[model samples]
Each structure stands twice: as C-alpha cells, then as structure tokens.
Target chain A: MKFTVQVNEGPYQHQAADSAYQFTKAVLEKGHEVFRVFFYHDGVNNATNLTTPPQDDRHVVNRWSELAKEHDLDLVVCVAAAQRRGIVDEGEAKRNSKDAENIADGFRISGLGQLIEAGIQSDRVVVFGD
Target chain B: MSEEMMDDEVVKKMAYINRRAPYGSIYALESLEVVLIGAAFDQDVSLIFADDGVFQLKKDQETAGIDMKNFSPTYRALEMYDVEKLYVSKESMTERGLSEDDLVVDVEIKTDAELADLLDDQDVIFSF
Candidate 1:
C-alpha cells in the first residue's frame, strides 16, 4: 500500500522524528510503498541539508537523508514554514537573497497542497508531530 | 492539481498534535512514535503544533548545558520516515512573538477559521 507520512517535529526536540523514521523503515520492510513526506511546523527543520553530529551522536539528520535517498522518497519541506525559518534550497536562497541555506538533502520545497494531495491519494496518511 | 480530481471518498484521517518545547521535555517525542506506529497500519495522520510547539524546530540546538544530549537537531530528520504533514496555528505563533521565520520547518500557518475548516474535514482527530 502507498503510505503518506507527515511529521511536524524536527530532530533533537524529542524522539518523535526518530520514531517516525523507524516506523517508515518497518513499513518498507513489510513491502509497503511510501508516497511522500510532508514536513510542516517544526517538522520542516527535518530537511536542513547541513548538519554535523559528533562522533558519539546518532547522526539523525544523516540517517533520515540516507533513508530518503535509499528509498527515493519525496521529502517535502513546507514552503511557508521553511522560508520563515530560513530553511531554503539553492533556488530559494538565491531568490530570497539569504546568505544561509538549511534545507537538507533528499528533500524538496513544496506547498501545503502537496500534503493535502497526499492525504487524498494515498491509501493511508500518517502524521507524527507535536 | 485541484482536489476535485482526487479521490472523492473520505479516508480515515489520524492526527497527532505535539504541543511541547524541544529541549526541556520528552512528551512530544514519545507521542510521535506511537502516532508513527499507527500510521504504519494505513491510518491517515496529520500533526498540529500550537503554542510553544514551534520551538521544537529551531536550528543548532545543543543540550550539553543541561547535562543531557541536545536532541533538538533531530527535528530535520523526519523525511526518511515519511511523517511530513505538520500544521501550526497562526494565532499561536503570534501569541508567542513568533512567525514563520521562528520555526525550523515549513508549516501551514492558518487562521483559526482555516484550522476549524480543516479539522471539520477530518474523519477523526486525536490530540496529544
């Protein structure tokens, strides 16, 4: 089945992001397909492209990016949420004339419509937030 | 594309709203895990972050001072897991002197009216 998962909590605040990550892995292991991921609220931080964890850390950012790349998932960062938090892509950074860009790899910038669309298309739409 | 072309039938919608801060608590994280498990079962999930919940997404968070490993940096890693439908109330943001620029993620900053409309559309709503 096609699953659309939405996570609003960014990394490090709590284990919500990690749990969501594990759940996705399990879903794929069970032979399920993930249609897309819509990050909003604090969740958009999950797409920041630049992050370095210490040697003793879990490297959560890298892990999520790896999962997206491995599964070819559409990691979507909400456009309004991202721009406000200074999480921008190459194009957005240039357009906004922002010196800093934070959106992570394997993630794209999109609108809330993508999320609503996901809810309408996927057999299931799961959300992890707050 | 317009929603008109999408599936007309209303599917089961599940939401896990996280209303906690990033560094000073654990409830927000634990609740998210349960929601993900539920989502794995083919449930429709949506997340709403109101109040201080917006702080959970700031960049460069370190927990060394609190003698706890700062986990705020983990917010950006939700994509591999596909949990992306996140929402925040505009009123909440404004109440706390926050705007779209204060959060780490891109969220739907809707008015109470819009949230009410969205909530009404949900077949089921769960708050945490």
Candidate 2:
C-alpha cells in the first residue's frame, strides 16, 4: 500500500516527529511505498539543518534526511508553515531576501496542495501531531 | 497500482478534522490554510469542527487585544471557493455554551454519532 505521512510537531520538543520517523521507517521496511511525508505547523522545524542535538542523542533532522536519501522519499515542508516558522531553503531565502538558508537535505518547500494531492494519490494518510 | 493505470484527475473524499482552539496554538490557523489550499484540488472536501475547534467560527472575534490576526472572517468566504460542506459538532457547541446563531457561517450541526458516520465515509481524514 502507498501512504502519505504528515508530521505536525518539531523535533526534540515533542515526540510526534520521532514517532512519524519511526512509523515511516517501519512501513518502508515492510515494503510499503511512501507517497510523501508532509511537514506542517511545527513539523517544518524537522527540515532545518541548523538543528544540533547532543553527541549522545539521536539527530532527528539528520535521521530524516538519511532516510529520505535511502528510500528516495519525497519530504515536503509546507511553504506557508515553514515561512512562519523560519525554515527556509535556498530558493525561499533568495526570494525573501534572507541572508541564509537552513533547510536540510532531502526536503523541499511546497504548498498545501501537495498534501491534498498526496491524500488523493495514496492509499492512506497517516498523521502524527500533538 | 500501475502508473499508467492511475487517472491523473482522481478525486477523493477528504475531511479536515479541527479539534483545537482558535488561538494559543497554530493548529487551527494552519488547518485553515490547508483547507483553503485543498480547495484547488477539486476533491470532495468536508470541514468538521469538534471540541475547541468550534470556537474558531464564533462570531464577532476581537483579536486586537491578543495581537493576533482574526481569521474568523475567512470562514464566511469558504463558499466562494466551493468548500461549502461545513459541519460543527453539536455536543462540542453545547459543551462550550455556544449556539448555531453565534457562529460566523451557516453549518450543519451534527451529533457525535453523525460525525462518526460522516468521517467513516471519507477517503482521507486529516486531523489538526
């Protein structure tokens, strides 16, 4: 089955992001296809490369990046939500005239239409939020 | 499913479930953003306001003191976008001491059981 996963909380501050990651990884391991992983609200925080956890702790942002690379996943951060939360990519930073971009690897900024499209294209839409 | 076999213009029954208050959290506003954008997809959409979410549609919201943008007016424009199916939880409204007359827009007041049946009929359920 194909699934679209939505994560609605930031990393470290809440368990929603971690749970979403684990769920995505588990489903991929079971050979289920992930149509997309949409980051909305505080979930856009998971796409920031500026995140740095303690050496002993798991790096949630990096984990998602690596997983996306391994699985060829589509990790989309909602543009409106990301703009409000200050998660910017090179294109967004340039367009907004910001000095730097902090969006991590394996993620792209997009509109909510992508979320709706995922819901239409996928077999199921699983959401992890507060 | 095969790529070529899937129709490019497939429509699905998508429901956006709002269970949070209008303020103190970003869920309600962001959920509204999704609903507005989801309108462009031409899917069968339903907006269900339950719990504190019913507060979002309360009429005459004064956000000047809170220093927040009052987006309640957008509810009234949903019909212009063809997103006219709005449902409010009757139990949630009664629990909050609110009535249908207090809302900014006209909506179908449904009981919890009726809301459950409505959700069961959706192809996708988005919770916020």
In model 1 chain A, the worst 10-residue window by lDDT is A112-121
DockQ of 2: 0.75
| lDDT at position A129, candidate 2 | 94
lDDT of each: 0.71, 0.94
The digit string of per-residue lDDT tens for model 1 on A43-79 reads 7777776767678988777787899889898888878
Clashes of each: 39, 0
Chain A only TM-scores, each candidate in turn? 0.93, 0.99
**Candidate number with greatest lDDT:** 2
Docking class of 1: incorrect
**All models, DockQ values?**
0.09, 0.75
Q: Quick one: best DockQ, which candidate? A: 2
